[model samples]
Target: MAVKSDFLVIGSGIAGLSFALKAAEAGRVTLVTKMGPEETNTKYAQGGIASVFSDEDDFELHVRDTLEAGAGLCHEDAVRLVVTSGPERVRELIAWGVEFTRSDNAASNGYDLHLEGGHSRKRILHAADITGAAVERAVLAKVAAHPRIKVFDHHMAIDLITRRKLERRRKGKDRCLGAYVYDTKSGDVEVFVAGATLIATGGSGKVYLITSNPDVASGDGVAMAARAGARIANMEFMQFHPTCLFHPPRGKFSDQ
Candidate 1:
């Protein structure tokens, strides 16, 4: 029999963890990952998160900076939405147990903000240099405490289980049912059925031979989605870190 839940989330990165936390409130959530729960691209992120947190900063200014950084490629509406909602999202992170670096001065409102390259103001809230890792650990702890969430680490998602394959109908639009997950340790393939399925796997950064993404960033989600007939777009815009510790011979990154 197929293991089932109300929501099946593939990947245990920040996006996956955050979504699972939200989904668990509504229904049971099954989170699957290809590696250990803590080993993710988020763990390697050394910078801080940017948001409008100071009196000197505002939503419009942040949006302008982001748009300028995007070089006319960013969608105005999406940029506006994220910029306007960033502070609340940061607050949500705080409420979920994320502890950012605190400001020593009483006037800075307790959280210390930094100025990054593109931003015009000091709006970056971080836990020292390991902001992403700190956020991940805190949220993952919350997820672990949530009774409705079940995390399956070392389980790789091979493909999406769409409605056409399971229900025996191939003519209409294919709705996703769940996925076929592989147990990396036991070499067993199993089915995970769910009412809603989400793939929050990080980008295909390792393909460049040198990236900040972890070893699990091998594009499993993109490949699975493409095989499941999802529209693949904007792949040309894949982010590449300009700087990395490049190791010669076979692997570009030292960790790999």
Candidate 2:
């Protein structure tokens, strides 16, 4: 039997959950995660989101810092878009109940922004040390309460069902219909038919022997996309350890 919905979302990380929460406003959403939604890479992010929320920070400076950090690999358009919209988008997270840390009455809003290594100013808004966990919890709570959203845990998407798979390889841009999902618990494959499908599985950090990313971050979604002929590139680039330089009132060598 085929399960149908307005949107089929794979993976239950921040990306997947965020998209589903918004998409559910207009139509029904069916979200599937390979494992329980709580075991996501998003919770591992200790550092927090970067946005221009302080008096000293601005979009251009943030964009420049990001471009410099990327070492010329980041797309300029993408950088600009993210930098400009970052504050607003992060505010949306706040609206969704992400309790970003707050301190120092220096700023008007009183957010405890951190001076991350690459940034020229203090802009990283966090939730103490478990920033990602806080974000994930907030979004997950909202997603759970949403009436139009249905969640399926322990379901892995094996492959995307594209138009090419349905019909012959004719021309014109082929569209995606849904995916073939495998239920780990039931040990059966189900066809998910949706008007739109989104893949939000996190990075492939588990490819390495020793990694900080959880075992579930095995890049399965990337493989699924590649198998579906979705142009995959920049495979060489990988983040060994996303740096977050912690600097308290004093130094790192000794506790002041």
Candidate 3:
């Protein structure tokens, strides 16, 4: 059977959840998560979102820090936009009920940010050690409360359906129409149709024999996107942990 929707968002991470919240306001949204909505790399982020919230800190410094960390491959315009708009976006997160850590009355003045590795200033807005958890929880709660947003957990996407699926060459470059999903619970396949689809599935830390990513982090989105004519960049770039304890006693570390 095929399920239809005005907008479909794959993955329940920060990006997909945020997009779903925005899209649900205008039309129907179906959020498909491979695992539970709360299960994602975003939930394990020990660090936090970088934003220039204090008067002492600004976009220029943030940009410099990001560029330095990005080495030489960071796009200048993208860096500029991200650093410049980061603070407002952080504020938007606050409006979404993400309560970042505050201290020294800084939250009242602006925000009490922290300095992480590769950063020159304390521009990271965090919620203790589990900043990502706080953000994800807030967004997921809102997503659950939204009447127009439908959630499907444990639905793994097998591949995307494009104009090619229709065998229609006249559709030009072949746009994405929907996807083929495997329901983990039902042990069956389902075709989901959507007018618009956004892929927000996070990292591919599982490709490595030793990693710090969830079991579901199998690069599903990257694979599906590449199969759908979308270019997959940064495949060679990955995080490898040499000291990862793979024993059952410490399997949690390898599970990410």
Candidate 4:
């Protein structure tokens, strides 16, 4: 069967869902997820969004701290952009219905920011402990309510439909038209066509024998993009957190 949309998004995490919501205003959007719509690594994030929210604290400090944390390899232009635009992103999140905890309590009426290990100030905005869950929920709710957005659950992409599939003679360039997807319920192949496509599938931690990631974190996007002539970077580095609790049976943590 053939399905059509103006925009097609593979993965329903924060990036995919947000792109779908934005594109829906102008055209039809089809969002496909491997399992349930909410099944994503974003829902499991415990850390908060870092942003300048206090008069005492400023953007320069946030930028410097982020650079320091990123080490010498951090890009100067990218760091500056983040530091300057951080506050606006925070305000945008608030306008989208994200409720951040207030920082000062009775003394002041503003966002209560926390400091991560790399952060220089109390600039990380959070909601109690599970900040990412809260932000994801808010964004998902709004995206779900948008009539232009259509979500397909339990659909997995088998492969991308490219120019080579059409026997094109082009040597250096290949174009992505759509994808061949497998419908788990019916056990049949479906072709989804879109003018624009976005792949927001998260990183692969499953390739490792042990990780804090979900079962679906198998580097699908990276593999797919690589096959389409995209370069892969930083495949060798793996950061191990000493604070990561590893039990015999439990992978990462116990129910809080």
Candidate 5:
């Protein structure tokens, strides 16, 4: 029998969980992940999310810094939208119990904003060196307690189901129905039907032999979306972190 839900979300990272939380307000949500919910790239991220939180920081400066970092490839509208809405989103995260590191100064906003490369001001809101982990824990806790959300770990998505796969008459436009999910523990493929499906499997860092990303960052979402005939863009834009630490600390730095 096929499992049905109002919303089927693949992967349990910040994007997936955030969407699930909002979707639950309207109807039931089913969240599936290939590994444990915490085993995601977001949990391993050392740097914090960039947001304008300081009085010294302004939206234009943040957007300009982001554009410079993108090497002229960023969409101005998208950059503006993110920069403008970031502070509110960060505040929302804090309200949800994410304990960000605070400044020792008594007159500050209590947050110890960190400056990163290409930024004009201190705007990164972090929780020590494990900001992503802190955010993940808080969001996961809220998701676990939500009665409208159901979680399925160790479930891998095989492919998306579309109207054509159902063998029904051609509609006005092709619409996604759900996906075929592989339950790793049971070694069975199950049908997960939903009114809407969201894929947030993170990046494709695992595609490279050497990377700081977790094992789950295997580009599953991108692959699945491509297979479903989605239009992919800017795939050539690959980024490498210059400050990543390699194993065997005593080994030659160049070898890493």
Candidate 6:
């Protein structure tokens, strides 16, 4: 039997939950995660989101920093969209109960911002050192209480279900219908049918032997999307952080 929803969201990271929260306003949403809802790359993120929030900062400066970081491969349109909409998105997060660190400066908005390697201004909006965790906590709380959103933890998506899988006779294009999920606890494969499906399963950090990402970052979403004939881009670019918290035996310090 297939359970149906208006929108199906895979993963529980900042992207997934944030999308689900907004989508729920229009229709019913089914959110699926491989582990507990809180276990995600977003929960492990220490740094903050960058935006032009200071009197000294501007969109051009932020875009220039991002372009430099991308090493000339960045898309100007995408960069412009993010830089322009970042402050409004941050305000939305605050409205959802995310408390960012405050500043004592009288000229500022009272929220403490930090400067990173590529940026020239202190435009990083953070909740102390665990900005992602703070954002995740607040967003997940809203998702849990929303009547239009249903969360399914410990459910792993094996593959995406497309129109080809349904054996439709008159197919104009290959459209995604839903997915086949595996319940880790019950050991059962279930069908989740939806009008639309979203894949926001973070990165493929676990593909490397050692990484700062959580165990759930197994590149499942990327694999599923590729298998479903989606064109993937920028796979050659891999960003590795210089410092990762070392855990004995499992995670050791990397010199690279």
- Backbone clash count for every predicted candidate, in the order shown: 0, 0, 0, 3, 0, 0
Clash count, candidate 6: 0
lDDT of 2 by residue, 201-250 (tens): 99877676556776688899999999888899899988775553433424
lDDT (0 to 1) per candidate: 0.88, 0.89, 0.85, 0.79, 0.88, 0.90
User: Across residues 1-256, which tens digit of lDDT does each residue of candidate 6 receive?
Assistant: 8889999999999899999999999999999999999999999889998888888888999999999889889999999999999989999999999999989865447789898888989999899999999999999999999999999999999999988656744445788999999999999999999999999999888788668887888899999999887889999888987676655544443311
Q: In lDDT terms, how accurate is model 4?
A: 0.79
Candidate 5, TM-score vs. the true structure? Answer: 0.92
| 44-127: candidate 1 lDDT, tens digit per residue | 778888898887778999999999999989999999999999999999999989999998755456789988998988889999
Candidate 5 lDDT tens digits, 91-173: 88988899999997443377898989889898888999999999999999999999999999999999999876576554447
lDDT of 6 at 128: 93
Clashing pairs in 1: none
lDDT of 6 at 87: 89
Candidate 5 vs candidate 6: the lDDT winner is 6
- Per-residue lDDT tens digits for candidate 3, residues 198-219, read 9999988877666677777888
Clashing pairs in 6: none
Which has the greatest TM-score? Answer: 6
- Candidate 5's C-alpha lDDT? 0.88
After the best TM-score superposition of candidate 5, give how far the Cα of residue 46 lies from its true spot, in angstroms. Answer: 0.4
Question: What CA RMSD would you report for each candidate?
Answer: 2.1, 6.7, 2.5, 3.1, 3.8, 2.9
lDDT of 2: 0.89
After superposition, the stretches of candidate 4 with alpha carbons farther than 4 Å from their true spots are: 104-109, 168-170, 249-256
